[model samples]
Target: MSRVESAVGVAFAAEAPVLIVGAGAAGLCAALAAIEAGAEVVMLERDPVPRGSTALSAGLVPAAGTRFQAALGVADSPGLFAADIQRKAGGEADPATVDAVAAGAGPAVEWLADAYGLPFSVVDDFDYPGHSARRMHGLPSRSGAELVDRLRDAAERAGAALLTQATVTTLFAEPDGTVRGVEAERPDGGVERIGCRALVLACNGYGGAPDLVRRHIPEMEGALYFGHPGNRGDAALWGEALGAERRFMSGYQGHGSVAHPHGILISWAVIMEGGFQVDAKGERFSDETRGYSEQAAMVLKRAGGVAFDVFDERIAAVARQFEDFKQAEAAGAILSADRLEDLAALAKLPAGRLARTCSEVERLKASGGTDAFGRTFSAGQKLVAPFKAVRVTGALFHTQGGLAVDGSARVLRPDGTSLPNLFAAGGAAAGVSGSTAAGYLSGNGLLTAVVLGRLAGLAAARLV
Candidate 1:
């Protein structure tokens, strides 16, 4: 809880080897890695606690070739995972960064579970979009809050100094872009200047900044901002001022199934499990299975900025595994009926159109044919009786673009050279996703968080 105080106007001398801004998954993991490497580390958090964008996520980190996957008889490898990412991103991602994350994800997950004692297990029940294997690892409760909490506890236990309510606003660096330290402002208008041998920016992205979002991803300007409010593009701004390169400025992760009025997130499992989304007019618009991130724009435009997610009892059972879905059910965001017309009545949709849509879906399932929107219905995954529905809206979860970095997460210059003693991870760095929302593979955010975080921590410690 102590901020190394300095003589007024004189910057504090280097108090630690590595100074990390932001205490989310990326910063916490970076601290753990630096501490493990025998470097004194200090993690500064703007908020009173460590929960950031990681807490708002589903707590799933997809990693190929993990022991949990092997134990479940699932075959996978980093090569396969990297290929999937490239395919999803349309080959727009940096090859080295993609390969590094895919290769490091498994080891990072295993390390967290084995060393930190986090109860992580493979999510074998269902598949997220763009992931070819059952590689998502999560805690027992499948909640991001639990993931952040456990990581925080582990980091503190491992001797990393976790300081809260320290909002870093300025960087103290040499004229040549060699960062020496930062200036963090407290709520009481007190300034704390902390110096370090190396610096890591894990403060996340700019989804919370309206101006930045409008400048980069103009399409999602009106959608609900579901990410942490503290993500104000601090890293990008700081990097730009320091002459660090930035890439994929338009990439982001958006969700299509946030339950409206109640503000609860309904898992996309409902759609992936053969359920469908309908507009207010009670008609299927786009291919719901294409990917949930892309589905956000479709839901907003095709569904008049709002829609209803229609699924059956079986899909609901699959969705019940998520805490957010359970919370949605408790909030009355989920409606149920045994028949399509009854369901339509509860949702106040056109009953005739709803019935016809259901019949068309059934026909497509029986014939195994593609619909007008080009979505092929699989006969094996059919929606049965006891239908459930949730009124939903689109939401911008987080930004995926920021300061460009090398495989080791060293902040790079515009000419592809590394900045001295500066690193970035998680949302603070450009992600593997390409320049659009469609390129986001499932769990790519956390993938970079743990993988690049550890890499940055180790690399920074070596520099120290």
Candidate 2:
């Protein structure tokens, strides 16, 4: 299987102590950490532009017991955070992995900000289902592209070699199952060998690969995939060949309010700030108070696999703060109207049903009672005049499954043996979102990416 091209050489790989595959949040965090720990680092990215699932995210990661949380007068603990994950996941996710990630979440996020100088702030006003506190840490621009660009710059400044447009075909290992180096296929039909004391797999999930989805996560087979096409399950494939165990293969995160034609994800914050989702029949099918990922299956099973989200001007004002929502508004994808009839006409929906639904939402808010879907709206946060609406549908974001790894981010075999000199993080490792889409706590993906990436990097550098 080794076809050595003339241009490919092992001299460069010989000098690098750590080799990271994938340039997304996980790989970049690994590179930064490994380099900071006094080791030579090199990163490989399959995409020419290097935008992976991390760039598709909202650039928010949940952290408990951070300085920001403490400053906001919100008392939170890693125990509480892990308990929230357990409750949301119904305890299907591995308890040890959840405990490990939760234990390191605050330190991982704070280290990135305080040490690497990544610009991040705790979203004190934001709230999500399953979390008792406002612990979402977001970038200033609320754009994951900015987050990627910043990490790229930071890694480069720290002297980590980032090689793009190179796809690692397979791992080079000894007969005793000790992984040694990687063989990458270049775009020009060349093979490059990069040797390292340790290899880290950060390539994201398999959302772009329909066959993989059908095999592991069958429920998301027909839905629109909003995640990057770069997530082709390279990690899982490689793991299988290396005799690694897979876990959480059925779990995923789905977005319920993806703007159909515009390709913009209407910010979930809109729903948190008094927005509502309605079907074409103009009736509220489910409670918008549920997590966006949790509502995806219901939205997809609806009559048209589409829904309209309506919000008042005040909620829209908060939504406008997000970059994606602002872009959607500028593109005329977001609709605004003062009258319910006119809004229904614009959306080609039933005006009468829309009116009744709006009234019911307000009544629920005023009465402080549980909705038909078992969702409750708080008092004094009622929707008011001048409504804004967007035509939306459900979409698969990322898979929450892959190779099962230990708490320190070591890939494990079926007998619970760690793969020697190999590590996984981000989408490559099993996530804490249980075994279904509904288990995704807000920001779980990025939180795991940051924490496990750092831990994997630090540990791998130690091995070198």
Which candidate has the highest TM-score of all? 1
Error (Å) of candidate 2 at residue 70 is 2.0
- Please give the clash total of every predicted structure, in order: 0, 0
Model 1, 1-464: lDDT tens per residue?
11222223556844778999998899999999998888999999999989999999989999999899999999999999999999999999999999999999999999999999988998777788888898999998788999999999999999998889989988877777877778888899998878888999999799999999999999999789999999999999889888899999999999899999788889898988788999999999999887888888898888888999999999999888889998998889999998888999999999999988988988998899998888888787777789999999998999999999999999999999999989999999999999999999989898998899999999988888
Query: What tens-digit string does per-residue lDDT give for candidate 2 at 264-362?
Result: 999887788767899989988887666889678878886368898888888888776678988898999888788988888889989999999989888
- Candidate 2, overall lDDT? 0.85
Each model's C-alpha lDDT?
Answer: 0.90, 0.85
Candidate 2 wrong stretches, greater than 4 Å = 1-15
For model 2, where is the 10-residue window of minimal lDDT?
Answer: 1-10
Compute each candidate's TM-score over C-alphas: 0.97, 0.96
Model 1, TM vs. native: 0.97
Which clashing pairs does model 2 show? none
